[model samples]
Target: MKTYHGSCHCGAVKFRIVSPEITSGVRCNCSICQRKGALMTPHIYSPDDLVIESGEDQLSVYQFGTGVAKHYFCKVCGIYPFHQTMRKAGYYRVNVGCLEGVEPLQLQVEVFDGKRL
Candidate 1:
């Protein structure tokens, strides 16, 4: 497992998560995801794997559809760092682009048919 550190574009929010080295990610065609255009971790992570190092107060939450999933972003920069998924309780999916030293565009990506939900 590896610990990845991430932050918002404006550096207002910072966080870390432990996961297997990321080699790929998922892209959702859901309305919100299609609009945001972020690549997310292919696997779900338990809350224990994630730690907000700083700027927790700088974060904001957004929810839609069934309002089960909670999307979190940096209020200052409007960069999405991670989100809690409705698919699995207390589990999260991190934005691959937000991770330091990671090339999100270079990873192999699979499209998720979230639009049908």
Candidate 2:
């Protein structure tokens, strides 16, 4: 697995995800996700696979509905980079677009009916 580095726009929050270069990511049609334009790579890793290299304190979280999914962003830049999964403790859905040098459009996207779930 290749280790990829990512950070918020302002560089306040930085993290790493160990995985193959992504060929696809999950694109949820849920209300909030659609509105925020967040294209996530769901279940890419357990929490153990993600390492916050710096600015842990700069991260903020948002949740709604069941509140099981915890969306994490940089408090300083307001950039959404990842979220904790709803069903799996310590598993994360990462923002592929936020991964350094990743092209969001290049990812083959799978659509999830998150609104219906």
- Decoy 2 TM-score against native: 0.91
Worst 10 residues of 2 by lDDT: 39-48
Locate the minimum summed-lDDT window of 10 residues in model 1: 81-90
Winner by TM-score: 1
lDDT of 1 by residue, 1-117 (tens): 999999999998988999999999999999889999999999899989989999999999999889999999899989999999877857999999999978997999999998777
Pairs with steric clashes in candidate 2: 47-90
Error of 2 at 9 (Å): 0.8
After superposition, the stretches of candidate 2 with alpha carbons farther than 4 Å from their true spots are none
List model 2 lDDT by residue over 1-117, tens digit each: 788898888999889998876777888888888988878874558777899999999999888888888889898989998888766755888888788878888878899887886
Top of the candidates by lDDT: 1
Compute each candidate's TM-score over C-alphas: 0.95, 0.91
Error of 1 at 72 (Å): 0.6
Give all candidates' CA lDDT scores: 0.92, 0.84
Per-residue lDDT, model 1, residue 66, is: 93
